[model samples]
Target chain A: MVFICSVATAQLPINWIDPLNEGVLQGRLADNDITGYNRLPDSVKSVVREPVWALGTNNAGVYVNFKTNAKEIQVRYTVSGALDMPHMPKTGVSGLDLYASNNNGEWYWTPGDYRFKDTITYSFGPVKENSHRIYRLYLPLYNTVTWMEIGVSSDATIEFQKEEESPIIIYGTSIAQGGCASRPGLAWSNLLGRALNTPVINLGFSGNGRLEKPIIDLIANTPSRVIILDCLPNLTGVTPENTERIDSLIQAAVYQLRASQPNTPIVLTDHSSGFNKNILDETDNTLYEQTTQAGLASFEKLKQAGVKNLYHLRNADIALDINSTVDYAHPNDFGMVKISDAYQRLIEQFLR
Target chain B: MVFICSVATAQLPINWIDPLNEGVLQGRLADNDITGYNRLPDSVKSVVREPVWALGTNNAGVYVNFKTNAKEIQVRYTVSGALDMPHMPKTGVSGLDLYASNNNGEWYWTPGDYRFKDTITYSFGPVKENSHRIYRLYLPLYNTVTWMEIGVSSDATIEFQKEEESPIIIYGTSIAQGGCASRPGLAWSNLLGRALNTPVINLGFSGNGRLEKPIIDLIANTPSRVIILDCLPNLTGVTPENTERIDSLIQAAVYQLRASQPNTPIVLTDHSSGFNKNILDETDNTLYEQTTQAGLASFEKLKQAGVKNLYHLRNADIALDINSTVDYAHPNDFGMVKISDAYQRLIEQFLR
Candidate 1:
């Protein structure tokens, strides 16, 4: 390794590595085309719900990691979509968020505000005077990456390690898909991926993240560290009669994921909003209460039915702070960071 | 006073008064139009920077305060413009943020979420069990409010409090303008306003927050608790030849503010992004370094000139964590909260 490092420094703009080729793409969808981040398989694209497939085109929690000693890091990629919404930037434009941690330390954004746009080959360098560091590059949350390249200064060495096979799989809604955040790395799942130093499979389907069998089959195919079901928001506007529909849908997904990887933790999350029944506006809207009720009822039903290793985060505190959310529905970077904190605390027992 | 209380409860949908009409609106421009929100006064509307006046259209830290015994609080208002940026919600569209604290205890958002679009009359209620409470409604950060009405349930009462004339006046960039925040109330200025129980003058012009004579003249007229100048981000990209221009602008703004409000405190903030010179990528941008240099030079020059009551918050921690900002420039709500904490701590000696 030392001899390899000595020779690596002689080459400037150290060799660019496509993480997808290396199989360390954390949030890349399974069975994607040659490009690792096609959002979903073409076969299932027509089957998934509207806005879900289209919005799914944006890569929210996707990321790749490597070790490098170069003082500067650079990226070159083309963002495929521009769904610029006022409430959500993470899912709006073509931009990537870069994070770095040393020797498995805390992650931090590079100092020079490494966000990119028209210029794809962006460099973040003179990093804290460190000889070697682990870097995580997040894809654009609101746009798709066609192809990409990551490189470091000529004098430094870049190393790609083996990939995690049974990575954490997150299945959820738009918020889980990275809504309203400024960058993909700002999404909670990406942050958790780095925080846990584990691979993550983001099955977040934007507006179409409702509990569906076709999607469950996709999730079941992937063995996982943990399966997080954060699909309550997409299950909005349900009527009294439809409660059973939701319960059945959630049950089926759980059973599928559990059957494939029974011992792997299957964690269910309640809608961040609508959980507090005490709020006046939401209580008046029976729709809000119904949503909360449905989520809670599913958890109870699942537990009573002898579903073991089921973890329920009934009330995640990310929604507690009204300010934390970008829009009322999606969390901004601050909320994203907080969500990661909550998940890390909740899942530490299982993952760590 | 007691006689007024008797009749208030007797009436249902207790008098819903427009705080603007009640003369309780604070942080609004000194002279606004019939609607009460002036994105920019006609005089400087064109003279100011492009996004500054456009962004200024969004009310930041502007609020209305009243005491109420009603168990529910409802807001009806129309947001005029929608300058939806993919970056932040606070500065993207029009929305209101509400907060309540009783007997001067902790502050909390009313249960359930209520954001605005075109015609908006949203209610927040079934509040945490409380009889009488102090309510402060924040205007939008990136949009203008045409008109607003605050009402309560039939069984309750609402009373407006006298507005504070000598208020804490904040002058800064979009962060000061509440960028990327889920709500206006999360902005540091608004949070500080509540923490200090003082009305705030939010002159946070977005990309246009640079100190200029025309703007400084406006700030000088107000009898302020303190004048906070947070325009470092706007000063970035300054070339070596332009150091004098920056020095002159910031110095003139400070000296001018001090000239009128002789004893009032004047706080200068450093560029959050450039705080750590140790960062690798930023050192390459000499423009970034020059900007920081210009700010420090002016601060030192003023101090040597024997400027009194001038406080400086050099390298505020808001930029320390990459997660703090929604984009690289504007803070997310958590960062906003942290900024508020730091401000409350630094300004406590002066205001509290």
Candidate 2:
């Protein structure tokens, strides 16, 4: 039993690594020709509506996987939007979420001190057990990361992991894009991926997931074992006009997915308003009731029309109570877990 | 059937009511000699430590109750600190959370749009049912409200409810102070109050809840059904010095409370960290492990000395997962609910 200690006069140098160079970028359709750390490629900028194209720039479900034995890890990144919303904190909107897994395969959330400035910085330090450990760093959910660099102690070793080829792809609204979660790691899509130990491509285009033909075509090109369409919440109301539009959109989306990926399991999720909203507020009742009906009717129609492997997840399955959300629309961390648990239960069987 | 409708061109004038004048201001130990919306009386300003006195200005568990039949409801208020935090959003920090109930005694959260400017304004308009209903508006958890006004349609009726005298009083640290709840209404203390249909005094002093003698004297004066001391998180560290200080403080606080309130039940809550921290971070493990041991030892010492009807709640009883918090320390909305559920389960039995 012996111990050796050294004292240095100067600070250790930091080695910055760009994830794109070697790291595994999960929740992306392709690695080539992508302009930045965006969920969508540059080709879609001209094809989709401006709102959808702009939202595609956000790194919602994207995460980078790597292993390092660095005593301290530092993140320097720049974001293109407001750091936070009135209801959602900056940690969920624009902060990096880092998770580490040990040899026993148990994952631990590593918290860090963060500063929001011109160039936001997060310092996760003093790696307690300095052995090489697997790390997954989730990117911001609602903000565009213009650039990012991960810095480690210059003397430490580092390696990048590979992403799973077939991911569970989600095409939905803001909720699916991680609206109002306390942090990026708690987003339902991200939670599902961690629970299943698989990758998940988030194609959620906040307020613009209208089942458009162009976006569906883009989703078709993505390689996925399972696909989820959760766009009804964004297109819900009691008016006859809204009812007609949602019914048609659901029909079109299922047909479009079936045309390209015949064997992929397509899950249609109903609008998840708090289940008791029908008894609480009239405006909410009208919107959610009609949306739920339209979603179920569409799912039944698609299944009867010989669409195999088609499934429907009702709002009741998500089990969101009044306290689950930050605002009525967005799931806070509590709501995020409930939605994630529901998806994990249904989607786990499909993945296996 | 005869149907008649009347139309008026001018906007309905608003009638503003001061909550201090008539509305039930729950969570206050006494309504007299309070300077503003602070939890403590002005007399204690010079007695307690400066940090504890400063945190007392925050309206953590305070809520105003009223019944109104107004067509529109408007809230105009000013907060004296930063509108929000890096990790906790404005909805929890400085925003007013409103909840309504019907005649059938079912509660519903009313959603509204808000703007945070020089003076924050929240509009929860167009009372859909046009019936008089009870409403509870929770004040900000982390900010001081300098002035506030509630306005209703001039034509409608309004009445303030009276607060119960015997509340479940909680004196503790930041988690008790609703450090990072998404909304003030979701704070565990408030949630427990709503669950048990009782008032709850939140004496959470952020980093200053050190079981000081002066603060315990203030707690002893409050008319309470039960008193919960949950200050272990703020007093935690690994050092032998830290353990000795916490042990003595806990012992003194219990003895001090017993001197004044001979019949009241006092609950001592252990520090609540994410249960997995012991296996994850050594620094966290040391602090929590030492704190947990100190708290249990103090609880046992008090009980062995014939402290009757005393209760102790462990961290595991709260059932916080890794996903429960915003930071490693502060509980988010998910964590708040977990803590509330634990308190509700324990406190409900005693209330009966």
Largest TM-score belongs to which candidate? 2
TM-score of 1: 0.77
Give lDDT: candidate 2, residue A24. 65
Q: Which residue runs of candidate 2 sit more than 4 Å off their true CA positions?
A: A1-11, A102-105, A130-132, A277-279, B1-11, B101-106, B125-133, B274-279
**What TM-score do all the candidates reach, one by one?**
0.77, 0.95
Give the DockQ (C-alpha) for candidate 2: 0.54
Model 2 clashing residue pairs (backbone): none
In model 1 chain B, the worst 10-residue window by lDDT is B276-285
Interface RMSD after interface superposition, each candidate: 4.5, 2.4
CA error at residue A176 for candidate 2, angstroms: 0.8
lDDT at position B279, candidate 1:
34
Residue A202 Cα positional deviation in candidate 2, in Å, after optimal superposition: 1.0
lDDT of 1 at A62: 67
Best by lDDT: 2
